[model samples]
Target: MMLLPDAEQLLANLTERMRSGVATDTAIVGIHTGGAWLAERLHHDLKLPLPLGTLDISFYRDDFDKIGLHAQVRPSDISFEVEGSHIILVDDVLYTGRTIRAALNELFDYGRPSSIRLAALIDRGGRELPIAPQYVGATLALPSDKMLALEKSSTGKLSLRLYDKNPMGHEQ
Candidate 1:
């Protein structure tokens, strides 16, 4: 059995690093689902002045034609101006980089930002595209058949879970 790192501690470390490095004008935007949850904590802990943004990225996914729409699709929301502002794109895991690509496609639709930095809770080693996280809480390696996921409790505690990848190429 693979021993996972503590999600809460990892998050605390990530927030501290971001607190010192992020630009004053930087905006935090989380990808839907897990990313959104992490972003919420980061935004509050970092004390960012700008409103938090969340991206669904469902429609922007490159494999949209193959997978079609997801069951729970939330609309992307960016209340602040995107042009000329620095953006910290948050995600739970950085794996294939395809999700980041889709997020970039959706973000540009709002307007070009001055800069965009990726922040991931975990950085798994597989990379199908050239993408890297500027800030990472942890780096873990696991078998191709296993998947890592972040879970949040009703009281807002965070934890990590390992699941066997479904044979159909979907997460359980």
Candidate 2:
């Protein structure tokens, strides 16, 4: 079994980096369930002025046709003006880069931001696109058939879960 990364320590490192790195007009936006959770924590940790925003990129995904729709698709909410705002886009894992691409498309729909930075707790390398995270907690090389995910406990603690796909490409 793969050891889970230290969520609390990773957040501390990310916070330390953002202290000097974030611009004055920066806004935090999380990519969905897991990302939203992280953004909430980061926003509180950094004491950001702007409200934390969340994006549900279910509609903007390229593989929507093949995978169909998600059961719970929450509407994206960005209260602040995105124009000229610097955005910190948060995610639990960085894999194929498809999610970030979809997130970019959705984010632009709100308005154009001055810049956007990608942050992830884990970067499991298997990129099908040219996307890379600006801030990452750790990078791990996993087999193509294995998938990594973040799971939050009832008390709001975080852990990593690895699922292995069988020879037939079915998740175990």
Candidate 3:
């Protein structure tokens, strides 16, 4: 099912939940692409203590050869201190958990934070690894043959849409 939320509502929900558990000095970090989109919104809404950090996990993926390099490779920016600081890792969607895994690897390369909490806009179940989002905008139980995609306009607007899979029972 397509259980998407309005961008404003999703932003409010995420900010509220993240503020509840996040330490006073917590930092916000977003995974590349979709995650970064959500993070930008949350950062503006929440007024986080530290500047936002954007990470590109494409180069850090274990299956890099299979997926190949993404067209865009944004640098992971966390110029501020990381050790002993609480971090909120943001992503657009949570599915197989491989992206989160790859994100963790990239995060460590910078510095080890005291703790890292996950935040996702949507959680579609199909976890290849044991990972969960600490804060979620919505949860959807989509059919295996369907796919969920998050898109953002150049103006920084965000939305989610569903696409039917091809004859091969995979997202086209």
CA RMSD per model (angstroms): 1.4, 2.6, 2.9
> Candidate 2 lDDT, tens digit per residue, 1-172?
7776777677777778777867557799998877888888888888889988999998988877766777789989899899888999999888889899999999999889989999988888787889888888778788887877777899988777888754543111
Best by lDDT: 1
Residue 25 error for model 1, in Å?
Answer: 1.0
| Residue-by-residue lDDT tens digits, candidate 3, 1-172 | 4556675577677788877786558788888778888887788777776888888887877666655666667877776688777888998878889889988888888877889999998888888898988899878787877777788877777777778755533111
lDDT, candidate 2, equals 0.82
Candidate 3 lDDT score relative to the true structure: 0.78
Q: Which stretches in model 3 have alpha-carbon errors above 4 Å?
A: 1-3, 164-172
State the displacement of the C-alpha of residue 24, model 1, in Å, after optimal TM-score superposition: 3.0
Error of 2 at 8 (Å): 2.4
Q: Is candidate 2 or candidate 3 better by TM-score?
A: 2
Clash-forming residue pairs, model 3: none
lDDT of 1 by residue, 54-103 (tens): 99988887776766787788988999999988999999988889999999
Please list all clashing residue pairs in model 2, or write none if there are none: none
Of candidate 3, the 10-residue stretch with the lowest lDDT total is: 163-172
Model 1 residue 105 CA deviation in Å: 0.7
Candidate lDDT (C-alpha), each? 0.89, 0.82, 0.78
Q: Write the candidate numbers in order of decreasing TM-score.
A: 1, 2, 3
TM-score list, all predictions: 0.96, 0.91, 0.87
Candidate 1, pairs of clashing residues: none
